[model samples]
Target: MISLARKSILHEWRRFAPAIFAIAFSGILLVIQAALAVGIFSTVAVYIEKSDAELWVGFPGTPSIDQGRYIPNRVESFVRMHPDVARTEPFSWAGGVWRSRPGMGDVSVVLAGIDSRPGSLTFAHAVTPVLRARLAMPGAVLVDIADRDKLGVGIGSSAEINGRKVHVVGFTQGLRGMGSVNIISSLATARYLDPGLQSADEVAYYLVKLRPGADAAKVQQALSPKGSNIRYEAWTAKDFASRTTHYWLFESGMGTAFGLSSLIAVCVAIVITSQTLMAAVAASIREFATLRALGAPTSHLRGVVLQQALWVGVAGLVIAGILSALVLWLAKLAHIPIALSVPVTAGCAFLVLCVAVLSGIAALSQLSKADPAALLR
Candidate 1:
């Protein structure tokens, strides 16, 4: 059956080309849509994801990192007191107006105050040691390379955050915020920029690093004991990152919007692909009738149709993978956040194959027109 299906597709390449193209294009849309949606929401957890901290201690019921409020600086002491803890650092956050220069409009920005000391765990993955060293300079700040134009500043350029002058010392990549631009600075700079965070006893959160071979979950439980008098909450790095992203993606309603758009794309793809396959099948009705007249069973012909659909799906998926890669590269060049995970790519390929199979089923109606009597006409 597969051999017959392959031969038929090869013999009628022109007839099936549209079906293949439709499947390929549809695959591209679905993959790209899923990538963009995931990438955008993943940014909501950038701080937690980009850091090497084993645990995060923050205000009770802090749904997400951005939503975190002041928790007592003593949270750091409590976290550090754990026997398995290696070190702890205070992570502060503030929102401020960025004034790049005269004539440039003010932009809303979120300031992340991180420990600039050597071996700091906060953003250790994204912010290099040199960048962290630069941040140690008072009033020096770092911004994502992608946001240079938006903030109207570059290295050596001076900007004002909440009317306090800040110098751009360096740039980092993949640190862009979901909505507002993200600015990285030392704790002192962030405090200076936002008067509200100047209270030395209060910080937004505390980052914890545990000794090698120590269990993070155990330490988290120790730091944030279960009791009615709990002052703060402790979260494993992985759990907090997931919570942060989940809050923005689902709790904030963005996931519903993205899901609807993706569903629409799938529907559009199914409709176009099914119509194309049906037409291709219809065009080959005479050949099918000839086979039927030669004692070929209808089930065999149906298998041939399904096999053809599978081949079309495979071909289209190959083309879509190539096209999606190109699109993702272009998006990167444009500074758009788009990422594709292995699972996501595999799921998308499965969906494309499912679409192809469904289209083949829809095209089965054309088989009814393959009557041997039609040959007499």
Candidate 2:
């Protein structure tokens, strides 16, 4: 029976060709979107993890890094007073523009400033070692490698930030914040842009590093009362990173945008598959009727049609999977953040097959209602 199904599929390939192409194209879109969503979320998670802080101290009522207010520098010293708190580092969030040449156009970049303190939980040390070394120098900046082309700047290039000249010391790969290119510099540089900031006062947040086996919750509680105006939240390094990544995935529009695109692709697949399969059924109506007259069961005919759909779906999925991988590879080569896992790609293929099956079933409805005697008339 399976062999017969295969034969039927091959015989009717021409009728199903359009459906195959449509399904394949839809699969490509879905896979690409999924890969990007995963990549962006993973990148954020990794960034937070490498910081290696037990607690993320931010302003109250601001749930995320981007929305929080700068904490005062005094809080850093105050938190360090706790025996559980081994150390605290100041971090600042700022924005600036980068230009390739002295008088060229500028591209906007997100600025992350960290204190010069040794063992600081800084972007430079945590995310990229190369960036850490480069940023250690005074007045030097690190730009996201992906933005180099757009900014028209390279290593040893100068860019104007806040009307002050800053030199691009090096480049960091896979570093971005909410889709913006990230630029890392010292706390002094950040302060220069927005100056006279007190040590604890000018920081966006504090990263609290705890001693080994120390109770992070107890530390948080102890530090919380000391800074009555500020809120202290503590998590294990892993948990904190997970929450941060989830924040961007669900709260930010990236998750919604990707989900909507997937839904659109599935809908398109359904429409295209249904129309193409319908045409195939219509063209082969006489063949089906003759089979029924020749002792072929309705169930058998249904099976044949469904088998054709399944074959088309599988073929389309194979082609789409390969195409999606190629696109993701090209994106990576171009330094874009698009991560594709095998499980995610496989899941997408399964979804495509399900959609194709439904489309084929819809086509079977017309076959079910046909009357063999009517054609004889």
Q: What is the per-residue lDDT of model 2 for residues 55-134, given as tens digits with 9 covering 90 to 100?
A: 87766645455555766556667777888888777778876765567555766766778765555686534445556666
Q: Residue-wise lDDT of candidate 1 within 1-377, one digit each (tens)?
A: 78999988888888888888988988999898899889998897989999988999998989999999998776777777788999888888989999988898999999999989888888989999999999988999999999998988879999899998989999999988888999999987888788886486678988888899999987887787687987899999999999988898889998888888878877887788889888888988999999999999999999999999999999999999999999999999988888889999999999999999998998899999999999999
* Highest lDDT against the true fold, candidate: 1
RMSD of each: 1.3, 3.2
Residue 342 C-alpha lDDT in model 2: 79
Q: Best candidate per TM-score, number?
A: 1
Candidate 1 Cα misplacement greater than 4 A, ranges: none
Provide the TM-score for each candidate, comma-separated: 0.97, 0.86
Show how many residue pairs clash in every candidate, following the order shown: 0, 6
